[model samples]
Target: MSQARPTFQPVHRTAKMPKAHTEVDPLLDALGGRGRYQLLQYFVSKIYAFTAAFQLLNFVYVARNIPHTCGQPNNISDIFTAIDDDAFTINNSDIFYDKCSIRVVANISGDAETKQLPCLYGYSFDERKELSIISDMGIVCDRAPLKGLGQTLLIVGQGVGAAVLPIFSDRFGRRPVHLISHMIVLALGVGVAFSPTFTVFLVLRLILGLFQQGIVLTDATIGIEVFPTRYRKLVAFLSNIGWCTCHLFLPLVAYLLRDYSWRILQLGCCSVSAVIILQFFFLEESLRWLVANGNPKQIKRLLKKAARISRVDYQHVLDVYDSLHSGHEQLDTKKEQEGTLSKEQADALLTEPVVHTVDDETHSLLDFIKDKRLGLNVAVLWFIWFTDSMTYFGLYFTSDALAGDRFVNVVLLIVVQMPSSVAIYYLVDSIGRKKTCIFLHLITGFGLVGATVVRELMGNTGTGAIISTAFSCFGFFGIFGAFGALFFYTPEIFPTNIRNVGLGTSSAFSRFGGMLGPFAGLLSEYVTWAPGAVFTCCCLAATAMVIVLPETKGKELPQTLSDVKGWYVTTDDKRRMDSIAKDGDADETPGQHGL
Candidate 1:
């Protein structure tokens, strides 16, 4: 028997294996992910971030209020001299300088008696500083409440636009909406600078807010969709860095134009929007969008161009795309002819790929809420966005209240964000999205709570002020880092069909937080610890919420609703899927099993 076994011959197999079509990620990788094409896309998309930062923070300087006194009444020509010599005192002593009313000695029945009179004339502003909306429009005194109206309206417009514009992007396309919004922003921005009155300025600011948020949404959408998953973190970092760069330079620009009209600063900020003209020539539509929306011709054209720039083989990419669409049916026919696959195996392999069609059926926020798992995810993202905006803008609006020079404080706040962005660039890729988000939230919560404790214990002493500023910088570092992470994470969670819609909805919530941010600073008047405490609580709550979200780091961006549904699953669902997979494997025909 041993001699016979040694003489036995080996059987040869001759079954031919079918070629598999590449998936989107693998196809993109083959076309050279993170290549020159991706870089060019990133560069163009990020230019809008710079302009957005400029518009958002410019108001801090543009609406600044300076010390002023009631002007001399036209009836009393020399009242200014009398007031300077202390002959007149402030009637409304409740206010430090009684900027609204002045006390004057009246010759009532030939007896000197002091009487209070309103400033019928305009205000006398400090000549040392440049003019602001407050000084130019006399927004002080009784009109002081109007100081923040422009900024408030701007934020309100952003909220409204965020709620509305992304629907158009989702329906039409990201590129058209982005370019149109950019052009409108430029026009509105210029219109704001040339505003004839504060009313006109306020109207323009509101309109500018709408288009600016549009630019933000569309730019981020296009940016995230064009790049491969691995490069998304990098895309997010670059977007943040662009904002930080503009933020860092904004104070310097304001300082240089300190002696000029606020309108000059406005004009200068709008000038950056001129970059849009270049985008008209260079920017490409998102390849992911092209695929999901079924613009195969455009996809092929984009792939060919990308291949040329990336120096990859265009024919190979075309072949992959061609096979991806047609291979299953063609291969199934061959397998059926050969009679190699069992009925179940053939049915499994023949199942059509999920296609996201642009139909009349609407995809809205309601759809997000209707799906239990997605609703939970969206709800968590809303809270995170709300907290992020509240803390970020809250800290910014209150920068002048910090210990150091106002300019220095603003600069420090902006500078710290640079390192925060860089840290997120690394942490999101290394620790993963869920952990990174949680870690950043904890840092923010602790930093803010620590600052509140220190401020409460030490009061407003010089030491306390310095320590509080340091703590604020620490907290801001975390919030800014979390912000960058959100940009990367939000897009990954949503499918291509509704990516803009989901991000837009989240941004709308953030605008609500932004609208409340200035008011958060006002809370310090009643409770010194109120703003910090609110921000800390928000951070902690966001941390707890983050723990429930699935980790998205290094995962491919979902293309359809089906892909998203698979991400967060129950134990039962996982088991069912596994069982089905196992049963299919067991039923597979011999010599036709997957390699």
Candidate 2:
């Protein structure tokens, strides 16, 4: 027996293991990173942004107040007519005739006792160049509040939609949610135009707001997911430009339609939805979403299409899929060899040869809350979104009060933001997301505070007003830059699995801020400096909060909860060391694993 024994040699075999799901980034890179396919998706997403801007701000023109006076009583028609016809000849005693109340003098005597009465016959609006909801629905005087209520409810619906719709996007898919939202938005936008009553208009506006958010949230998610990390800042800048273009275009449309009915303007705005037809034909589902949600078939289909359109080798994409498929087989074989695979598991694996399931645990809002590090990140982002949105919409709502023509002031506000958006395009990639955010927040805070101080010191003179407007524009520039940066950064921080949910939640908070913005602008009516002061404080607070958040520039998009955990090293490292120690790898050092 001893003589029969022989020496044996050990052989090493190299197995091609499947890469992490996140490694799809490389696969995409090979398929031509930021290539034709990505650009096409980017442009399609921008179409939604373009139309949304028009719908979002159309209320400003549609609900503007026009010059009006109380309707004249039959008994005093001659007196009021003369007063209206000869504005200079009207005395102080005739002033009430031009207001919500009318002065009734007994017997038309010069010394007759006069009483102030509400406009009993309804208000008579002046012949103005433009018609508005104020004139059409008689939302004047006591009903003026209804105009603001419509706008507020629309924003509230946006908040609710942001909170809810993206959950479906995460669970079902981005493409279907995006397309369906666009269809609903197209329908609702037209419905808003033809609404028969003010009540119907308000309700439709609210629902329109909800679906509008769905389009926005999904489009942004798809836009970010499709492109490579290198192009995210550029993508964000282009989106801001699209938004600015719409703003510039909308005012022109409003001016041209000045003599037309609000319905005409609304219907014209709805025309932009025609782009949805093209989207249906061209837009593809997000590749990252497909990969994370365990749809290998869809991933292969999308990648192949991308390869065809992008002019990359088709076999490269197939090779990537094959690697993923091979990884699943190896995992199953090991499980079976270890006797951990049940009979049913082995049978299912044998039957479903191509389906490579990653972690099957579904995530929810609870995942965000239960995870301490993620929860902190989400809370900080919520606060930042709330404040940034509040300040942005607040400044916009108060633009008419600036020193220039109302239309010119709004256009200037939007134009000023263009430079900031361009600046952010460079700054975000250069200085990093956190620093860019902090710098922009400081600019916003300082600019707002300066405007408030100048307005207080100069006391409403023309010079003071001009200087204040400039400073406010400066603040607007900063806020717009910050807004773009936030949109770019938010998706990067959250992992692919819950990216839409995280963004949707932050947007929900921003919508709440937007809902409050009109009221914050109203604060200026009572406390002249209050809105600016409050906005400055918010900017400062957000700046401080931003310091604690992680920077995501140059990092590959995280694909799962485990990837997100790496953002906090102290916590993740401790857990990693514990797991390794329990697994009998006590000699492994943190540095060896690149922890």
Candidate 3:
């Protein structure tokens, strides 16, 4: 007879304590036996890395299309213009018609100005003379309006998607929703590459925006739920790094394709999207979701496949599963007398009032507004997102606006963030999320205010402008910490069940600020220093609001609406949690997070 195959024993869903109950470990248990489980852990890590890469592609593509150069594009120096002759340098002074001219006051050679000859660029007599006046001023802009429309559509789509994501995550499952959303964006991105006219391209970009919204929110939702609590900060740090990398990639693309058409930029983005789409096969359904669905066998198979891919030995994983199994048994035994909700009933409780664990709908937007606790948290976060986004985009765009080689300056500005991102990784959890957020917001506000003051007081000379921009950039650097902390903090504010809905709603609201941030930069040109002051005020207001919010530094994740509504209510005080496990039927699916 063949040697007996080694038996496979799956771990249990809930953790057990010898004397009482403990938390569930479905996710840890799902890894199954050791050899296979270790492999699965490695596979999950790659999936996360792939997600970051995909998000980075979006930021890089945006920076490329919207050139950071000070003036607009013109036929003479625009992307389409080419070298007429290698021997002769461009000097169109003799061919000028007043308006379409660049005066060469003196010939500057070897850092010395000589009155040898003055040259002009452009022509006097031509069929395009009238059009040339506007064109020669570098007047016929392409990227601004298109970029604004695209950004707006994206924000609107984000709002809509955030509104519906709770329902979607529940109905479709996290991984499928994430993959399908990315595929939608991939298809629309190709449309962006091939768009013949500006009008059609704008429409396609809007649709693409909608898909982008779902992809991020869903992916974030999954990332928060799947990772153990100890590892959540790692997700935030990695996401920030990915975001900062996009800035660096922008300058690289700008430098490489400075003379290339915008279509080439879109094509590059599409290529990245295509690669991300291919990685979807490796993406796994959140193990947390599997427990909620009561599919232990499926979880086992999923972990086994991960083990094969990750190349880890099986025994180590088996040991973890056994520990979790024993823990769950203890938990269930203790709960036998206390009671528990049936799985189907638990699922329905998610949207129900009062059930908290992934199933509680503790508060809606309306409820949040009415309840002081929920209302204050929502208000504070909304402003945090708004201020963080505005300052972040403003600094990046302003760096582009200042006089310098857009590529190098943009790249260096992004490079400064490498240290900032690393810093966020170490401090986010150590300092406590609330403290980190407050500290960064206050620093960012002061820095922006200081930069604006320096610019107004010193005037716009090269040295002064550069100095001001440095302060502005530094101030913006602090905003990254504020932003990274917010993602982790926001989802924790609300109870588990409606956590996705609350975050999605808030993110959608917050993204409106992102939509406005670009336009705010545009407005800065006409309004002078007003935008800076307005931003400073917004940051101050946001900081004040944040200071007043509660600290969740050491609190365990709440499991039910009762947890939120009755945080003070306890059976030890002699009143049971009213045993919602049956009558209230709180959903136990597990909470989801959104970005």
For residue 167, model 3's alpha carbon misses the true position, in angstroms, by 3.6
**In candidate 3, what residue range of length 10 has the lowest lDDT sum?**
12-21
Expressed as tens digits, the lDDT of each residue in 204-295 for candidate 3 is 76666666766666666665655555656776776677666655665565456555445565556565555454446456776555544445
Using TM-score as the measure, the top candidate is 2
Rank by TM-score, descending?
2, 1, 3
How many residue pairs of model 2 clash at the backbone? 0
| Predicted candidate 2 versus true structure: per-residue lDDT over 1-595, tens digit per residue | 5685332211111111122345556666877888888888878777886568778888877777788989866665555554453322334344366567777544343454455667777777776523776688888777777878778888988999899999899888898998999999889989988888889999998998998899998988887788777878887888888888878988888888878888888988888889999889998888888878887777788888889998999898788767765666666564444344443443344344343335444566667667776788899999999999999888877643444564676587777899998889889989999999999999988878878888889965689877777777788889999998898799888877788889999999998788778776669889988998899899999999998788888877877665565556433465665565456443453422332
- Compared with the true structure, model 2 gives a TM-score of 0.85
- Per-residue lDDT for 1-595 in model 1, tens only? 4553222111111121232322467567767788788788778877886678788778877888788887755555445454453434343222122577766664444467565657666777776333687788777778889888889899988888888899888878888888898989889988888887889988989988988889899888888877777788888788888877778878888888888888888888788788897789878887777776777778888999989988988999887777665654565554454445545454444453431222222355676567876788899999999999999888876543444564676677777888888888888889999999999889888878877888899975689877777777788889989988898789888877788988998898998898888887679888988999888889999999998777888777876664555454322244544554555433332222211
lDDT of 1: 0.75
Off by over 4 Å in 1: 1-22, 74-98, 105-114, 128-130, 327-365, 399-406, 569-572, 579-595
lDDT value for candidate 2?
Answer: 0.77
- Candidate 3 lands at a TM-score of 0.68
